[model samples]
Structure formats: C-alpha cells, structure tokens
Target: MANVTFTSPRMQRDLTVYAVAGDTHTLLSVAKKNKVPLESDCENGECGSCLIQVSVLSGKAPVGMALTEKEKTVLRYAGKITQAQIDDAETNDRPPPWRLACQFIVRHEDILVTF
Candidate 1:
C-alpha cells in the first residue's frame, strides 16, 4: 500500500492510500486521519461540487494509453492535469477520468489542494 498526501486549508498531511477509494473516503478519510475540516456535498463524483486541485507527485503515473472521447476533451482543456498526466486505470469513465477531485484517482503521492 502507498501513502496519499493531501495539503490544503482544510486538510494537510498524508494518509494511507487505497485503490477504489470513494469520494467520502478520499476527503473524509483524509480529514479523519489528518485531523482536518473537509466537507463533501456529494460522495459521488458529480456536480464538480468537490472540485479541487490535485497535485500528484509521482513520476510513475500510468500513461501513453489511448484516451476516451470525454477524456480527450478534458485533456484538451486541462489546467494542471493533462492527458499524459493520467494513468491507464484512471482513464476509465466509471470512477471518472480526471477533472474533478470527487472523481479522479491518485495512485502516486499527492499534494491536493481544495478550491
């Protein structure tokens, strides 16, 4: 298991990372573990409601794979995240391919900031 870090006004500190971690677990888990005050309107990845800037710090991000049509569009307009910045599993639409925090997954180390 790898360590996941989240830094922001509400939360700061790294927590144990797990695959398939839901939105509530993503923030609530981090907050509970790190003693932070983070809130989630919806647990699911939608509304862009829990949008945050996830600054991943791992060079091992799975990339080079083809992207879905939706992913292609998001990759085109990515601000800090690019198509090359995503991993293969993270490319799937189920958990979301990236763009929103409530969606994207962080396999590598991260310094996520809440916006």
Candidate 2:
C-alpha cells in the first residue's frame, strides 16, 4: 500500500503534479487512480510514447530504477534526450529512461509527476 497524491502547479490548473503512492513510482497507478488522461499505445518502453516527467522524493526508496537495454534504445529515438538524462539513469538505475509503465509494480511516495 503506497500513498498516492497530486499537487496542482502554481498557475496552471490543468498542469498538475501527480504523485503515485506519494512518490516516484508508476504513472499507470496514478493515472488509473486519479483518472488522468493517458494514451498508453504500446504500454511497453518500446515506444517512448507514454513519456511523462516525474521527480523522486528526497531520500526516497529506490523503486523502479533501471531501464532495460531495449528501453534505452527506444529512448534514443525518443528525440531531444540529453546525455545528462542517460547519466542520471546510469547513476540511479531508475528514472530518466522512462520505465515501461505496464511492466513495473508501484512502490514510492511523494513523486512529482506532470500530466
């Protein structure tokens, strides 16, 4: 059981921060729970189509931290990805490479996600 939450951005009402289990976890969980709009075409990391930004809580538990090699390749075609992002994933093994939302289970708190 994780704590899921969402915080609206300062000015934009539609632009909000979605927290799954209250942390950087899965978009599928939060999207499903809050009914956030999504178009999960492949549902796998193969398409980089469901890419969403998320911020992990400080000192948060390590949830889904590594992208499969295949996912990394998809990200290569994701367009406009920075080496910094790749480095970030290298360090944490989770994050940046965009996890396959359908592959991992939810387990995190206080993650700031934008929809």
Candidate 3:
C-alpha cells in the first residue's frame, strides 16, 4: 500500500488516500478510485493533460520517479521539463519531478501529487 496525497490549488483542498498497488497500478488509476479530481484526457500517455508534479514524502529513496519515454516527449514538448533535466536523470540515476500521471505506477512508497 502507498499513501497518495493530492493537492489541488483550484479546489483549495487536499486529500490523502491509501492505494493498494501492484505492478500495474498507475497513479491515475488510484486517483480515479479515490475521486481526487485530477483532470485527464485520453487516460494514456498520448496526451499531456494529466501532467503532475510529484514529490517523494517518505520513501526508500528521496528521488521522485523515473519518467517514461512518452512522458519525456510530452513534457518536453509542453516545456514542463528540460532536456538537461532528462540528461541529469539518466546519468545520475535520479528521478524527474514532472511526470504524466497516466504513466506513473505507484509503488509501495508515499508520494505527494500536485496538479
């Protein structure tokens, strides 16, 4: 299980919910199950509508999470992330903060999500 906290500035509210995650459970799925009010289109990595900034709250590692190839392309095209950041993540084994919610799988770690 992972604790997923979502904070929406537009709604002026935040919710903390528990998610039972397996290898297939993405953040978007958990959000939908808990009614976190995340706006998403396509429900896949093809569109960038579900882009979110993620932070590690308490985990085995402080790093955020790895970005998928589709996430890298969309976020880069939208200017949400830079190539330099991608390079850093690749070379340093670090995680990028920006991610497509649809593509990010929630592991057994607590995370904070902002959209």
Candidate 4:
C-alpha cells in the first residue's frame, strides 16, 4: 500500500488517503476518487494544469522513482523540469521534484504531494 498526503494551503486543509500498491491508477485518478481539489484540465499527460511537487516522505530518496518518458517530455515542455535536472536525476538516481499528477503512479512509498 502507499500513503498519499495531499496539501493545499489555499484550501486550508490537508488530506490523507491510501492506495493499493502497483495499481495502474495515476495520482490524479486517486485524487479525483477522494475528491481532492486538484486543478486539472486534460487528464492525459499533455497539460501542465495537474503539475505538483512530489516528495517522498518515507523512502531512501526524495522522489524514490524515475520519471516516465511521457512525464519527462510533458514536464520538460511545461518548464516544470529542465534538461539539466533530468541529467542530474539520471546521475543521482532520483526523480525531479516537479511532476505531472496525471503521469505519476503510486508505488509502495509514502508521498507528500504539494500543489
């Protein structure tokens, strides 16, 4: 299982939810299921409206995962992540902080997501 903590200062509340590990569901799907108010236009990975900063709360690495090729492309185009950051992530074995919620899959890691 994975614990997902979502925080929005503008909303004045924080939400915590659980998800099955290794599911095909993306973070945006989980948020929608739980009624978390995440702004998203295109649920696909093309739009940057669902972009959020992901932080691993309990894991060996901050991101604890690598970006998917689609995520890399969308995030790079949205200017949420840079090529230099991608190179650094490759060298350091961690994902970039910013990610598209539509593309981020929950693994067996606890994550704190901020938007």
Candidate 5:
C-alpha cells in the first residue's frame, strides 16, 4: 500500500488516501475515487491540466516509474521538466518532481502531491 497525500490551495484541507501498489491505477483515478479536487481536463496523458508535483515521503530512494511518451512531450512543452530531467529519470531511476497525475502510477512508497 502507498499513502498519497494531496495538498492544494483550492482545498480546505489536505487529503491522504491509500493506493495499492502495482494496481495499474493512475493517480488521477485514485484522487477521483477519494473525491479529491484535482482538476483534470483530459483523463488521458495528452493534456497537461492534471500536472502535479510529487514528493517522496518514505525517507528512502524513490522507485521510478516509466513516463509515457505523451507525458514526456506534455511535460517538456509545459516547461515542467527539461530533457536533462527526463534523461535522469529514465537513466538514473530518479523521477522528476512534476508529473501528469493521469500517467503517474502509485508505487509502494508514500508520496505527497501538490497542485
């Protein structure tokens, strides 16, 4: 299980929800299930409206998840992540701070998400 905490200025308080690791559910789905007000224009990775900042809270090295091609293009175009960051994520297994909630899969590690 993973604890995903969401924080946003639009919300009254922070919300934390549990997500099963390797469940193949996106973070956006988890947020929607929990009634978290994460704004998303498109459920797919094509849009960057669901972009969010994720921080690892497990006090351990974060396990990197492969980013989709759409995510790479969208994030890069939005100036949320650079090519160097993407390369680091792919090569060093280090995830970038910004990610598309629709494309992010929750791992066993706890994380804090900010929009």
Candidate 6:
C-alpha cells in the first residue's frame, strides 16, 4: 500500500488515503473516492484542470511512473514542465513535479499531492 496525502487551502485539513500499488486506477479516481476536493474536468487526459504537484515522501528515490502522451502535451502547454524535464523523465525515470492527476498512477511509495 502507498499513502497518498492530499493538501490544499480549499480543504479544512490534509487528507491521506491508502492506495494499492500498481493498480490501474488513476489519482483522480482515488481523490474522488476519498473526497479530497481535487478539482478536475474532462476525466480524460485532454484537460489540464487536474494538474497537481506531487512530491515523494518516502525519503527515497521516487518510483518511475510513465507519463502518457496526452499528459506530456497538456503539461507542456500549461508550462508545468519543460522539454528537458520530459526528456529526463523519459530517459532517467525521473518524473517532473507537475502531473495530471487523471494520468498519474500511484506506485508503492508515499507521496504528498498539492493542488
């Protein structure tokens, strides 16, 4: 299991939930299930409204999670990530801090999500 903590000024307090590692569920689904108040539109990866900042909290290297092509385009257009960041993520397995919640798959590592 991995601990996913959601934090935002829109919420009264931080909320943390457990998620099964390697599950097909996206972070947006998890947020909906837990009522994390994460704003989203177009559940698909086409919209960038579900953008979030994810930070690994396990005090270790973050697990590599693949970014979908749609996610790359949307994030790039939003200026959330750069070409170099994308290249690094693709080549070095280093994910950029910004991600689309609808495309992010939780790995077996604790993480803090800020929206």
1-115: candidate 3 lDDT, tens digit per residue: 7788999886568899987755587889888988788889998798999989888888466444577888899999999889989988888866778888899888777889999
Task: For each of the candidates, give the backbone clash count.
Answer: 0, 11, 0, 0, 0, 0
Give the local distance difference test score of model 2.
Answer: 0.54
Candidate 2: misplaced stretches above 4 Å? 1-26, 57-64, 80-84, 91-94, 97-100, 103-105
Task: Assess the local accuracy of residue 104 in candidate 5 as a C-alpha lDDT between 0 and 100.
Answer: 96
Candidate 2 local lDDT, 29-110, one digit each (tens): 5565666555477776666655555555546655555566656676667653556776776786556624445443455454
Query: How many pairs in model 5 have backbone atoms within 3 A of each other, for residues 3 or more apart or on separate chains, i.e. clashes?
Result: 0
Backbone clashes (count) for model 6? 0
**Which wins on TM-score, candidate 2 or candidate 3?**
3
For each candidate, give its TM-score against the true structure.
Answer: 0.42, 0.57, 0.86, 0.86, 0.98, 0.98
Q: Candidate 6 lDDT, tens digit per residue, 1-115? A: 8999999999999999999999999999999999889989898999899999999998998877788999999999999999999999999999999999999999999999999
Clashing pairs in 1: none
Which ten residues in a row are the worst by lDDT in model 4? 59-68
Window of ten residues with lowest summed lDDT in model 6 = 58-67
Better of 4 and 5 by lDDT: 5
Instruction: Give lDDT tens digits, candidate 1, residues 1-115.
Output: 2345555554354343443332324544454455544455664543344455444445544322233444335434655355444443355522222344444444433434444
- Assess the local accuracy of residue 102 in candidate 4 as a C-alpha lDDT between 0 and 100: 91
Q: Lowest-lDDT window of 10 residues in candidate 3? A: 58-67
